[model samples]
Target: MGDDDVLATLARERGRALFGYAYLLTGQAHAAEDLVQEALVRTFARRRVGFTPDSAEAYVRRAILSTFLDDARRRQRWSGVRHLLGRHDEPARDPAPAVGAVLDVRAALATLAPQERAAAVLRWCEDLTVPEVAARMGLAVGTVKRYLSTAGHKLEALLGPLPDDETVPLTSGRTRP
Candidate 1:
């Protein structure tokens, strides 16, 4: 398909799902929508990534993730500059109580370093295997495994223990604690 055609089809077929994933990462409706649209332009129109139709969604998902992380880092740097200039905003309010565990998990996920968060989300949320996540994130399998390990400990520290079913799988050369 041509660039516009491919983007049109992806938006028609996967738009809601893509927006939902972006929303989970960003926690804002307008930002989520904009992120998905931006990802489409970068992935398809710009041809920044080579892809087959079968892998298009995965590629786009990675684009969304990378874009989100990039924006986050940019915002953090800008915030630091503002702080240095003696500007401050009031502390933000906590999430509504009704949102509870999901929000807590999201908050915990935010506390993680980027690589750990990406590894944990891909392995546990996206249900990718170690080797698969390694390929997706362009890291070695051992590195992915270590990221999962560090993310697990960090998450457990922040949120306490997870249920057995929620635990990440140990790598082949590793054993569970």
Candidate 2:
């Protein structure tokens, strides 16, 4: 069959399934519909060699996932720079908390043992994985973990508890400890 025939067949037979998949990903009926429509447009934008109904549906589903992920990444990037889009630059805000927090952290680090301080710095500041921190310090993994745990406790006591779910790494090759 031709491309238009394949597209028509897929939309007639597999449209509900595609909409349901998009709904699962987006979690909103309107958003799901939009995603499905966008995916359909993107999938059929390029000419395909031999696209049956099933294959066309598969391609559309893949396009939906790609569009969703791309949108999420774009939103994240936009959020980081969105402040610059506004014209209001308030000059009355105090900037000392940013400076004070750095001093406070430095002071807290001074109180920790040398090994504990080193582990904390490598793991949090350097954004190294547990194994990487251990390798850099010439210590065992368990040893590095222990030092980090102790250092975390010490820092928390001084700086107050960090957010329970906050565990993003700055720049690491693998998962953060």
Candidate 3:
């Protein structure tokens, strides 16, 4: 196959996984899609005259990581201003009864620092080992462990104790009796 055909085939096979990875990083589906597209575009632009498939996947993954890190930094810079605008102006709606558990998890996740959130997502959601997460996040294993521990503690505090009953409401604002 021609070089373009090979590239297209590889993208077709890996695009969904790439998007999923991006979503894990950004926590927003639309932003994740945009990140994946931007990463692919940047990777294609910097493509070498003769690159192997093995090298290409590594390159793409690196590009995705760079994009996510850069985007995080940008968001951090604007977060203070965004927070000042406040959430009170937002529209209200009925909460999803079934998704209360999911929303509780998301809220707990939001309370974590960015590195902690990333560490938790990489370790749990992505099923990456501590060493693997450290490598991917460019941190030491000790640092990753600390981040994960901090995240777990914060989640426990925010979520409170788990009830004996598995069917207990996660966000119903009621303590187990």
Q: Score each candidate by Cα lDDT.
A: 0.83, 0.88, 0.78
Candidates 1 and 3: which is better by TM-score?
1
TM-score of every candidate: 0.44, 0.48, 0.42
The clash count of every prediction, one per candidate, is 0, 0, 0
Better of 2 and 3 by lDDT: 2
Candidate 1 structure lDDT = 0.83
10 residues in a row with least lDDT, candidate 3: 164-173
Off by over 4 Å in 2: 87-177
Question: In what order do the candidates fall by lDDT, top score first?
Answer: 2, 1, 3
TM-score of 3: 0.42
Using TM-score as the yardstick, the better of models 2 and 3 is 2
Q: Order candidates by TM-score, high to low.
A: 2, 1, 3
